[model samples]
Target: MEVMKVLHMNGGRGVTGMGDSSYANYSLVQQKVITMTKPITENAITQLYYSTLPKNLVIADLGCSSGPNTLFVVSELIKVVDQLRRKSGHDQSPEYQVFLNDLPGNDFNTIFKSLPSFQKKMRNQLGAGAGPCFFTGVPGSFYGRLFPSKTLHFVHSSYSLQWLSKVPEMVESNKGNIYMAQTSPPSVLRAYHAQFQADFSMFLECRAEELVLGGRMVLTFLGRRSEDPSSKECCYIWELLAIVLNEMVSKGLIEEEKMDFFNIPHYTPSPSEVKSEVQKE
Candidate 1:
């Protein structure tokens, strides 16, 4: 038995991705959100770390993908748990409750399909669940309660919080100015700040509600070089993508009306900005 469990919970991760293009659109959206955490290494010495590191803990992963990527992370987390257990000096195996979570629209069926193989590998290596590993699939918005009160000891979310519910129509409309000049004009940057402020506040409130007191949360979100909340380069990726979309529209690849429809529900919060939000928790 694996006493402890590990998780990469991506709460409310798939909210921004919507519409008739549910398949490809979701992938693109997830990619954009995950890009923020590409450099993440999962430091073992964060403030949220355990003092003795419990050998038995319930772990949940939110916004987990539905393919090889998801399984790979699960394996890595399990490895972490294994390391923690070995130090405990107890030969007794721990019972693991691994929670794989995501949006209701996430490909849960596909994730389940790969579970048998994961279990097989774990059983061969450690000897736990039905065969050797205990695995569980939990589908829901991590933004709210994903588990019972104080049920989880450790939680992790990677490259998933940058997502906002959805970009407001008024902000994305053609009627609004969308230029970000490094010089005199600051409206674009100010608007961007306002947008981030709105979503970031929500993100903080939601996470605070889900996590129990003393429960640690590990998260990696898209960040920016500018300490200022109003940096023009903060969202240059989306701007570039918009330009590309316009090019496609000129070639009749997509409708011009959809230029406003193109949106990635992500916001790169600065360290200070994130710190301020965390203070509210």
Candidate 2:
């Protein structure tokens, strides 16, 4: 799947669409990511490392955006493995092969530039016993296979699953809204849900093929607490953006018609929806 646009924090920092202009920073977002997934990630690492401390371990971060956060998950995983090794009575560290996957259009140059510094830091922090880390970029949509079968032991993805493989068909009819909104018609909601199901299922299937039998994947993304797809908790942020766009149209800064066809290719699945997908997959 392809992303028609690249939407990211302004200048690689704060939350999107906030007026703070408060210098770019991902601390807030990073905190949420860690809060939601750190425990699970830690547990998964413990289990994986103790279960079979493979001498050579392979990890991939799907939808790994380019920035400081790109290596955050990898760094944490490495540390966990190191600690687990000690607890498991192992003396030698496992060799690491990390693959960073994102769309082909991602800003890979920045990641490549940061690799030298990242490697140096890892070396210092993880020590000589920390086996060599070979980081490589694998550009592609994670909805399909990007690695050889059973090649990956752990996979981590954060702040990405909300994005569908592509925009749902007939979403152009979702006028006056850029994403799921209270005003969106039933058909629009169905289209979005269907697209999410298809995309997420493909993601699971592909990962299932790539991971070993006991491999683990830690994924975190936006989701609604309520079952309703258009619940305010999920769609309110887009609603706020729509309000801003309407104001822009009133000020003649953009065309009124432009808002009619603009829609974000994102879907916030409820817990049940996620459970269903996992069970089905």
Candidate 3:
């Protein structure tokens, strides 16, 4: 039977366990974080100089999931801004107001619990005369407005935007697959691509409204180097997972019907897709 398993992945047990299984402590994910450091530093340096320096800076880190990784970008910003302010011979450090945003169901308390250490580290890095740094939690989906118009100076997000806001309609024809797999029908592939396009466009539109005229945003998420959405980088892992799940179905460990309709609401777009969305925005 071709039917949709209307599962809302959000506000589920996944939200609660996220902080525990966080990418912050994972080695592979940490490597990506390291790889991003140079570009982020350069971007901050460029943006800091690209405009007249503001005395009070407003910064937001979108998709700021709970864990050490959540503070990774924020700490980097504090360092860059502090060093630049000192180098420019400014007697006073810029006061920073940082907003950490994520879904309302996210474990923000974990982030809240870790703040003392984060602030202490910031103080230790910036010295005893560090500027006032305040961090606030803004819980909501980034596909819509989270902050006021033209208020943010800098925004950064890492390894988050692969999630679609919702699954596309008419995916029942693409049965027996949990995501974009090698055997996924052309119709299934088209539906997934269409969803990504819609969600990503709205993401850009919302961010454009929130950013200042010259504000900068740095985002790095899952994406394929090739134009093909079903390329190995995008679909291989899900393909393997599907194989395992189907194996379970064969062994009678999982219901065959459940296997037929389950689909993951995640999409890894190609570089061209991202550039197109940015240009459209």
Question: Taking the tens digit of each residue's C-alpha lDDT, what string does model 2 give over 1-281?
Answer: 23634543333322221234421244467656766778899999889988877899999998776666777788989999998887767889899999998877666666777788888988898776779999899988887889999899999988888988787887348877888888889999999999999999999999999999899889999888999999999888889989999899889998977777778889989999999999998
TM-score-better candidate, 2 vs 3: 2
> What local lDDT score does residue 238 receive in model 2, on the 0 to 100 scale?
87
The top-ranked prediction according to lDDT is: 2
- Per-prediction TM-score: 0.69, 0.89, 0.87
- TM-score, predicted candidate 3 vs. hidden true structure: 0.87
Per-residue lDDT of candidate 3, residues 50-120 (tens digit): 38588778889887766556777777777877777777788787788999988776667767777887788
TM-score of 2: 0.89
Candidate 3 residue-wise lDDT at 118: 76
Relative to the unseen true structure, what is the C-alpha lDDT of residue 141 in candidate 2, on a scale of 0 to 100?
Answer: 81
What lDDT, from 0 to 1, does candidate 3 have? 0.75
The models' CA-based lDDT, in order, is 0.55, 0.82, 0.75
* Model 1 regions more than 4 Å off: 1-56, 128-133, 169-195, 228-234, 250-257
Top-TM-score structure, candidate number: 2
